[model samples]
Target: MITTLLVANRGEIARRIFRTARAMGLATVAVYSDADADAPHVREADQAVRLGPAAARESYLNVEAVLAAARATGADAIHPGYGFLSENAAFAEVVTAEGLTWVGPPPAAIRAMGLKDAAKALMIAAGVPVTPGYHGESQDPAHLAREAGSIGYPILIKAVAGGGGKGMRKVERPADFTEALGAAKREAAAAFGDDRVLLETYVARPRHIEVQVFGDAHGQVVHLFERDCSLQRRHQKVIEEAPAPGMSDEVRQAVCAAAVRAARAVDYVGAGTVEFIADASAGLRADRIWFMEMNTRLQVEHPVTEAVTGQDLVEWQLRVAGGEPLPLTQDEITLNGWAMEARLYAENPAAGFLPSIGELEHFVLPESVRVDTGVEAGGAVSPHYDPMIAKLIAHGPSRRVAAHRLAAACAQVQVWPVRTNAGFLARCLEDADFLQGEVDTGFIAARLDALAGALAPSDQVLAAAAQGLLSQTPVPAAEPQGPWSALTGFRINGPRQGQVRLYRDGQAVTAPLVDGPLSADVLLNQAGAIVVFEAGEAFAFTGSPPQAITGEGPAGDGVVIAPMPGKVVAVAVSAGDKVLKGQTLVTLEAMKMEHALTAAFEGVVETISVAAGDQVSEGVVLARLTPSA
Candidate 1:
């Protein structure tokens, strides 16, 4: 009998579990690191505990700290929300051994499906079709090449350990196999400490479609249909939707049946996902889809599944952990409508999707969609964790309606100072190919250039910004009302005719005043910039600052400032060193990504303000350069 529940995680997923825990009449406890002390998940829980410092290893991933939190809160059940230790088999064992309910699958099941090679073998043994690959223990390069030849050209070399597209490489030619294999092995070793890899035939046009499977302790497993996750960037899912666009009834039955068989093979309990890879070169078919891998915990995209099936997955986890039978049988479960979800992250897409950490000075999400988030308007996006702060979901009777709704919702996001990928996501959802349901894993990569291009406020947005600026500057009470007078500000009855020059992306745009006022939302951010929400994208404009005020680049004239808050990892140049334009100067590490700061022009380094170990905030000068004579 589970009474109180402790979520051994943070951010959106933790809060997501807590929401369900509350509705089920169960108390909820939250554990957070120093970085997440004021996180939304913490305040929402009935009880909260501080694990340790800002580092995840000292807090979230520290098994002892987590157990202590649960014990202190008197929590009888623990839910390992996705990521961190959600897939750790040993953690699951420890939780159960402590006489506390583990809201997940058995430790044996997690271990069975932990490694790619072993998982495939189990699937094959269970009569579940898997991708044609070599999962043997032999690591000889020559032998692996031979197997690749049999599997045909364009094969993938994937590490057997962890996921998230790390330690994975695609070899399209026989000659490149050896080189790609070595690189994949090196990365695999560095990432997971295991160089062993498996090879599979690379599908020409691959679509990532996975079945959401739920099993109970009573030996019954049911599928909640499938979700199309083909819209991805570097194998990380960006946009996902339930009931794949073109999935036929026959194809769905075949894949879902295989998923059920795979789950039963390990006597799986609780929420799990069986991912499948489909060769969509000839469109989705029963014979084209093959088993990929299984996620032993609730997936990040589970909300879309719930939207389409009208079921609460977290409640299912709790009920099952309490030894209850399946809530609804296979026949009773049904897919209702099309549901789409876009991952809302605090990152700058135009700058290669680097994490952007700062206070949410002007945060506001769209009210037209279902939002699941772990941060608030006044919260800060911390660099100590993942950048994803929320998930936006939209459900409709048809796929097109859902896509349009989600796209509009993406456009309605109003975050400022801290950059976001909202604009990029809106473009992806509104893309012509995406709208027509023509997508594959490489869809985003193929059109990333256009999708992530630097966005400039539209004429309408410029007009809105100009009006907002005019309205706020306190117009002189003595201004002329004559038709010939310069109409510099917005008129109460209509838009006064005038021209306002606004700078965007370093270029000045001359915006002609609209004949009427716009319905666009506008706000004055803390940075003293006039912010206009274009569909939800924040367009901050300045009212033509002084010519000398470039905002950055002090009198030294060659200042290199940190683009975002990060730790200085390397100083490539010293005082008195000459460097060419575009040469690497310093490398900054933030949000698990490394960014190289470069010399904007040929110059001599005059001073070094930071070292390799120093943590720097955005706009902090890292080095000063003087133009070479």
Candidate 2:
């Protein structure tokens, strides 16, 4: 029996696992880096240990440090939540070798499916349907280009190791193959420490469906249905739902059976996901679906499955790892209500979805829905981890009702200076195409313009802001237009109407306020200049004073600055180098993702301030460029 459980991860997943472990009367330990000393997970655990510095390699990903922490904490088992070393075969092997139970599938199963190339071969040998691709050992760029030609145009280049859409690129033509290959390798190497890549035919109009499968030490395996992660942006899942829309019983049965077979083939134990890609051009069909890959750990979107199946997956993992059989037989398992989960990220949809870093000054979500989050109000969102702030899940008897509740919850998210993708997610849930279940992997990309459009502050929203700024309460409708109605410096008895200056998106606009005091509910968060008002949808406004700039040059001429807190991964140019517009000046790796900084216009490089390995904070100048002489 496991008495003490140490979670070998951090953030929301760590808190999630602890909730289950503590409920089961087990002592829980949390490991955190220097950056997360005060993180919620640290306080949530019975014991907390410092791993190392903020860099993942020296901390969370350092297997020796993790094992040492478990031993120090007297933990009998280590739960490698998701990400980090969750699917690392070596980590699992080391934990078991140390005589501590590893709360995951065996190391052999992880190794069997760790590499995409090897996993595909194993799947083919097991008679599981596989996508046609080049999974060869030779990673020669020229050879891979030739294979892409053989596989036909519009092929997908995927890193042989790792997941989460890193190191993956879509090549639309032969001309772009080489550059794409170089980029794919760099990202793959940085993310997974592997540069090898494989090619496959890009499934047009594809739907990403994955089945939840579980197994036991006693060789029992069963599936708990599938989730549709079709709505995606830049290959990352944005929203997910269970009992995929438009799924037929025939296709569901076939996919679930295949998932169980895949699990049993690996002698899989605990929770794992078998992902499949289906061609939705002809709607849901059993034969059109092909195996994608398997996630050998719990998924980020597991709450939707839990909501629909009425099961706690973490509890099952603990039970299975403790020498127990499968908790429920396949015949006894059944799906109930329809459920949906929307991931709220600390990012700006209007600003290329670049991750934002700051304190959650005024974070608040609707109490009506299930919100799983690691940070609270006033908590910091560090650049050292994923930008996801929380996940909002909703369940109902029907898909329409679930979608409606989830959409409402999205709009109710109130955050401050650090912008969020709540508005973008709200738009996705309310879009007609998504509501009708006409979504695919390309759904967000195709409708990005509409989805990321800035919402102009409505009249009511303006009034609420005015009320909060003026420090006025709701007045009766019968009240006549009085002298104190407007916000302005008054001269003697002034008129009731006047213009109020409000800044939004850095532009100051005059909102005309008429009559007496505004009659609307308004809330002002003292931490920042924010005003919140809840009607059919919740809307919040951050007031900013207009800025005056003296320069009349190009918008990005002066200096190239780091957009967010990150490390300088590569510097492509040096001082005195002449560069054309759109030339890449440097590459910055932030949040384990690479972002290229480009020359805004034709210019001459004046100075390079940072080196390849230097860590930088937001707005730090990396290089300066002057106009051509």
Best by lDDT: 1
Candidates' C-alpha lDDT = 0.87, 0.86
The count of backbone overlaps in candidate 1 is 5
> In model 2, what is the error at residue 202, expressed in angstroms?
1.0
- Given candidate 2, what's the lDDT at residue 378? 84
Candidate 1 similarity to native, TM-score? 0.87
Lowest summed lDDT window (length 10), candidate 1 = 474-483
**lDDT tens per residue, model 2, 260-302:** 8888888899999999999999998988888889999999999
| Model 1 spans with C-alpha error above 4 angstroms | 138-153, 171-196, 474-495, 546-589, 592-629
Clashes of 2: 0
Poorest stretch of ten by lDDT in candidate 2: 472-481
